[model samples]
Target chain A: MDSGTESASADAWDGEIETEIGHDEYDPYGTLTLIGIYFVIIALLWVFMYFVEFLGEGPTVM
Target chain B: MEIHRYETIWFAASLLLIVGFIGTITYGAVGVGVEMVDDSGGTVDPDNLGSHERFGDTGVHKVNESHYEVNMIAVHPSFIPSEIEIPAGSTVTFYMTASDVTHGFKLVDSNLNTMIIPGQVSEITAEFDEPGEYGFVCHEYCGSLHHEMAGNLSVVPEDEWGGVDS
Candidate 1:
């Protein structure tokens, strides 16, 4: 093969694989789902602690 | 700089979280009418605490029909008038000072906590809605017997409460 053709083949064999996916088209549905769960948990804990642990624990200072 | 949509969303969520915390605290202060301890208790001389007017007669006193005042002194190893009795369903203000070193007063299971400095009086006001017995401790490490420095606060019923006269 010619030098240019050989170089091109070598570049292809160097572990570079082309794909149809683009950076902008990458969907992070899994990340969004995990973060949504985290948000719900944090909100619930906040409510429980504020209402149950704090306000319910009476004899507080006025 | 370019930012991802998810990053922007997360940033907004973090801001909302902070604002939510501040709002909750504000509601507790304004809506629930929770007050904090301030410098209104004034100052006193640690050396002459025995001769001071209020600390000299350290005990619980009924100020009015619904209000009470407690004058307390934190000495080295114990509190003067170790047992404090007050009436439930009344507002009680604690005026405290330390004689030798800095100390701490923390009423257990309650929100009353303050530092008792030698020359400064620490004051906190709390209301007891139910008759119960609570314990207080010197939370700050001042001396060798700091761990043993504790007291009791008894909130008795209105009918069972013997006022300062009794």
Candidate 2:
């Protein structure tokens, strides 16, 4: 283990490169999934609030 | 600039969401008949409310069948005729004005809400569908006792409704 004796370099790193994904190929499936879930939740809440809560509570100004 | 496919989809989705929101609001305004409070209630001299025709005698006025009118004044920490009783299935128009400063009137559990401004009458009309007890509060911060500035609205059955006190 040549700890500090070896100068820090890209080649000196212990990790091995597996596969590289380019910007075009890198599809953020996790982020897209999360955002989709959030959109669904927000849409559901909006429908419930506007239709069920507000519209249902009548005696509104006509 | 080149955009990612997911980013483009998200952008389009966002635009659709915005349009959907506007569409919902339009539907509420046009189809559902939800109206915003406007200056249609006409203006009034806050100082001379005492001698004014309607405000001179503030209370509920029966306007023949299925219609009623309420003349109310909002003072520092109380509404004149704080407890208002009306019949169910009747349309009531409220004409309100503030003598001192600006105050807010928001009826709990109903869509009747407006700001009472000095020298200007805040008028709003609402229908009483069911018989129930509803509370109204001054939402605006007026004075030290603003928290206690509240009132009650009583919607009684048609048969139980006693005509306005002469």
Candidate 3:
């Protein structure tokens, strides 16, 4: 079964000018990846410390 | 066979790991400790940066004793809200959510340090025992203007509030 509105919307075409100006030169992937890795490590350490906080000892940053 | 620059890469990685560890613990302290989550068990709202609203009227809010709510939206790079006004010597709950990336929310009066995740909300409740000018910061790494994400909260005397400014 096909709804009239849905089918009409799919077929309707009005050529629209793209308003977005794309940035093709910038690549932040590597930076983001590095940052992501950094936080993951810290989160693991915090989990380790949360349990330890109760014992009155947080891990030293050596 | 040509192998070169490997040492530099290793050095960088090591440095990055060390820095990351220090940062993460700070994050866990502010984010994990509070069990900071929203009504749906998810801290982030998938659409907006952190306001829990995907678009339009984005950002966190606060509720006063008289039940006056203020919405903090689109904080600029300076990390400071352009303006904040609250009744003096009153308890105002701050609800913060980032509209883009991660931002740190802290209050000078309360020393609140919390990481607000994009698409998630981080909430903090603070009481201004005395009326005064208070400033805040975004501690998390957000962007080129990370250092600039700052805002302020003002505490005014109860009488200062409009009589019906509930």
Best by DockQ: 2
Which ten-residue region of model 2 chain B has the weakest summed lDDT?
B157-166
Model number with the top lDDT: 2
Model 1 per-residue lDDT tens digits across residues B36-102? 7888889998999889999988999888999989999999889886899888899988899998999
Off by over 4 Å in 2: A1-23
TM-score of each: 0.88, 0.89, 0.45
Q: Which residue runs of candidate 1 sit more than 4 Å off their true CA positions?
A: A1-14
Candidate 2 per-residue C-alpha lDDT over B23-101 given as tens digits, one digit per residue, 9 for 90 to 100: 8889999999899999887888888899998899999998889999999999989999799999999999999998889
What TM-score against the true chain A does chain A of each candidate get?
A: 0.61, 0.64, 0.42
Q: Which ten residues in a row have the lowest lDDT in candidate 1 chain B?
A: B157-166
User: Distance (Å) between predicted and true CA of B111, model 1?
Assistant: 1.1
Across residues B1-166, which tens digit of lDDT does each residue of candidate 3 receive?
4333444455676687777666765655664443333433246553544433422442223343544344444444754244677776554544555556666666554445566665555544444556677776777666788676677766667777543222
- Give the Cα lDDT of each candidate: 0.87, 0.89, 0.53
Tens digits of lDDT, candidate 1, A1-62: 69999999888769656777765577798998899899979978998898778866766667
Candidate 3 docking classification: incorrect
Q: Which stretches in model 3 have alpha-carbon errors above 4 Å?
A: A1-62, B1-70, B74-81, B162-166
- The 10 consecutive residues of candidate 3 chain B with the worst lDDT sum are B53-62
